[model samples]
Target: MKVEQIYTKCLAQGAYYIFSEGEAAIIDPLRETQPYIEKLEQDRAKLKYIFETHFHADFVSGHLDLSEKTGASIIYGPTAQPDFEAIIAEDNQIFEIGKIKIKVLHTPGHTLESATYLLIDENGKESAIFSGDTLFLGDVGRPDLAQKATNLTQEELAGMLYDSLYNKIIPLPDDITVYPAHGAGSACGKNMQKETIDTLGNQKRTNYALNQPDKEHFVVAVLDGLTPPPKYFGMNVSMNKKGYKSFHEVIKESYRALSPEQFENLATTESIVILDTREANVFKDGFIPNSINIGLKGSFAPWVGSILVNVQTPILLVCDKDTEREAITRLSRVGFDNVWGFLEDGIQSWKEAGKDLDKINRITAEEFAEEFTPDAVVVDVRKPSEYATEHVEGAYLKPLSDFEEWVKTVDKDKPFYIHCAGGYRSMIAASILKYNGITDFKEVDGGFGQIKKTKVPTTDFVCPSKL
Candidate 1:
C-alpha cells in the first residue's frame, strides 16, 4: 500500500492519494485533474473513488472532473447536498480498495459534512486517518467559515468540533498517522503547524485544540481570533457545491494571447482588471498603468482571492514570459475562471510599443529612517494582529486584505510611506495605490522587518488579545 500527500505550497492545501493492488483513491483534490490522471497511469491503477471531506471554501475541488474522467464514484459524508451526484456515506460506513479498508468517521465540525477517513492496511491494522479540516497538526479548523450555510453560530460549531475530536477521534489508536488538509499558511486554521503529517499520539500530547479542558473552553479557544474569511471563499464553496466550468474549458478560454494594443484597448475600453503577476520588486520598478500587482512570488492565490472579491471579475494578465499558464492555473484554483488573456510577450511588448508605463516610488528602510519625521504619514499594511503586536510609532493600520475599502480614504495629495511584514504585501499595496491614482506615497523596500532593525521607533510588542 502507498499513501502520498500531494501538498500545494501556494494554497497550503494537501490532497491524498492512496493506492493498493491496482486500485486508487483520491481525497480532496485541487481544481487541476491532469496531474492525478497522470499519477493513475504511472501507478497502473484504476481510480475507484474520490472522497470529499466537505464543501471546501478555499479552492474549487477537482472531484467532479476527476470522477467524470475516471468513472470513479464521488463520496461525501452524511448531510451533504451537492448539486451533482455523489454517494453520501453514513457514519462508520466502510469501503474497500484491494486488501485495504477505508472507514468513514463522521466528524462534522469544520462543516456539517466533514469526516475523517480511516485507512486500515492489508494487515487489518488502522494505519492512518485523513482528518481533513477537523484536525490540524497543532490546531483545529476555525468554526466561523460555515456559519452562514449551517445557520449555526461559531460557538455552536466549535462545540460540535470539540465533540468530534474528543468522542470520535481521540479514542483512536495512538500510533496511527494523522494527515490534515491544511497547514500553517492556510486561512482554514489560525495556528496550524508547519508540518503536514504527525502521529496521532504526538498530536494528543502537543496539539492545543486536542488538549482543551472542556467543550466550552474548546469553543472559546477555537473561536478566539478568526479574521474574516477571504471574500472569494463563499464563491469557491458555491462552485464546489454546485458544479463549475471544466478546467479544460477555463484554460481554453483563458489562453488567448493579446497583442499590446489589444491588451491596452481591453484595459481601457472594458471593465476588465489588469493583474500583474510578476515579482514584487520587479513590478515596483515598472508596470502597466492601473495594473494590480499580486506577485506570483508570495501567497498569490489567497491575496488575489482577498483583494478581488468577485469570482467573475474579468482579468487580463501581465505576467513574466512563460508564467501565463501558471498564473491562470493558480487563479482558477480559487474559482477565478474569467481570465480574458495575457499580454503577449509580456511587458516588454508594451515597452517596445512605447505605451505609457507607471512605477512606484520605493525606498530602503535605512533611507526611510533617515528621512523620517515624528508626524510623517506612515501606513502599515500588515494584519491588525501584526499591527497590534508591534508597529512603527504613529503608523496607521490599513491591512492589505481590506485594501479596496481603506485605499479610498487615502488622500491623493498627501505623501505617505507604506510597508508590510516583508516586501511582498507592501509592493501589492504600492501597486494598488498607484492604480487608484494616489502615487505620492513611498513603499519601504523591506517592510517592517527591516524598519524595526533601523533607528525607526516602534511601539513595544503587545499581545493581540489585549488590543
Candidate 2:
C-alpha cells in the first residue's frame, strides 16, 4: 500500500493518492488533472474513484474532469446535492479500493458536505484520516464559508464543527495520521500549522481548538481572528459545484505565445488586464504600463484572487518565458479562466520591440529612514498581527488584504511611503494604487524586512483590548 500527499505550496493545498493492489483513488485534487492520470498509468493501477471532501472555495477541483476522462465514480458525502452525477455516500459508508478500505466519517463544519475519509490499511487498522477542512494540524476549518449555502449562521456552523471534532474525529486512534486538505497560508483555517501532516494524538495534545472541550470555547477559539474570505471564494465554489471548462481547454487558450506587438495591441484594444508574474524587483525596474504585479513567487493565486476581484476579467501575462504555463495554471486555480495569452519571450521581447515601459520609484530602507518625517504619511501594508508585533514608528497601518477599503479613504494627492513585510506586497500595492489614480508614492525597496535592519524607530505596542 502507498499513500502520497501531493502538496501544492502556493495554495497550501494537499491532494492525496492512495493505491493498493490494482486499484487507486484520488482525494481532493487540484485544477490540473494530467498529473494524476499519469500517476495511475505509471503505477499500472485502475482509477476507481475521485473523492471530494467538499466543494472547494479556494480552487476548482479536478473531480469532474478526472471522473469523465477515467470513468471513475465521483464520490461525495451525504447531503451533497451536486448537479452532476456522483455517488452520495451515506454517513459511515465504506468503499473498497483493492485490498484496503476507505470509510466516510461525515464531518461537516467547514462546509455542509465536508467529510473525512479514514484509510483502513490492508491490516484493517485505521492508519490515516484525510481530515479535509474538518481538522488542520493546529486549527479547525472556519465555519463562515457555508452561511449562504446552508442559511446557517457562522456561530451555528462553529457549534457543528465543535461536535464534528469532539464526537467524530477526537475518538479516532491516537496514532492515526491526520492529513488536512490545507495547511498554513490557506484561508480555509485560521492559524494552521506549517506542517502538512501530523498524527491525531499530537493534534489533540497541541492544537488549541482541540484543547477546549467545551463547545462554547471551541466555537469562539475557531472563529476568532477570521477576516472575510476572498471575494472569489464563492465564485470558485460555484464553478466547482456546477461545472467548468476543462483544464486542457483553459490551458490551451491561455498558454498562447503573443509577440510583444500583439500583446500590446490586445491590452490596449480589449478590456484585458496585463498581469506581470515576474519578480517584484525585476518588475519595479521595467514592466508594461499599468500592468499589475503580483509576482508568481509568493501567494500568487490567492493574491490574484483577492486583488483582481473579478474572476472574469480578461488577462494577459508578462512571465519568464518558460513559465507561461505555470502562470496560466495558477490563474486558473483561482478560477481566472479568462486568461488569453502570455508575453512572448517575456519583458526582453517587449524591450527588443522598443515598447515604452513604466517603472516604480523605489527607495531603499536606509533612504526611507534618513528622509522620514513625523508629518509625512507612511503606510505599512502588513497584516494587523504583524503590525502589532512591531512596525516602524508612526507608520499608518493599511494592510494589503483590505486594500479596497483603505484606498478609498486615502488622499490621492498626498505622497506617502508604502512597505510590506517584503517588497513583493508593496509593489502589488503600488500597482493597485496606480489603478485607483493614486501614484505619488514610493515603495520601500526591501520593505519592512530591510527597514527593521535600519535605525528606524519601531514599536511593539498593542491596543488595550488585545492586551
- Report, for every candidate in turn, its global Cα lDDT versus the true structure: 0.92, 0.90
Give me the candidate number with maximum TM-score. 1
Query: Which residue pairs in candidate 1 have backbone atoms (N, alpha carbon, C) closer than 3 angstroms, thus clashing?
Result: none
Compute the lDDT of residue 247 as modeled in candidate 1: 96
Per-residue C-alpha lDDT of model 1 across residues 66-166, encoded as one tens digit per residue: 99999999999989999999999999999999889999999988999999999999999998999999999999988898889989998899899999999
Instruction: Please list the residue runs of candidate 2 whose C-alpha ends up more than 4 Å from where it truly belongs after superposition.
Output: 461-467
Residue 52 C-alpha lDDT in model 2 = 97
199 in model 1: Cα distance from truth in Å?
1.1
TM-score of each: 0.97, 0.97
The digit string of per-residue lDDT tens for model 2 on 36-150 reads 9899999999999989999999998999889988999999988998889999999999999999999999998888899999999999999999998999999899999999999
- lDDT against true structure, model 1: 0.92
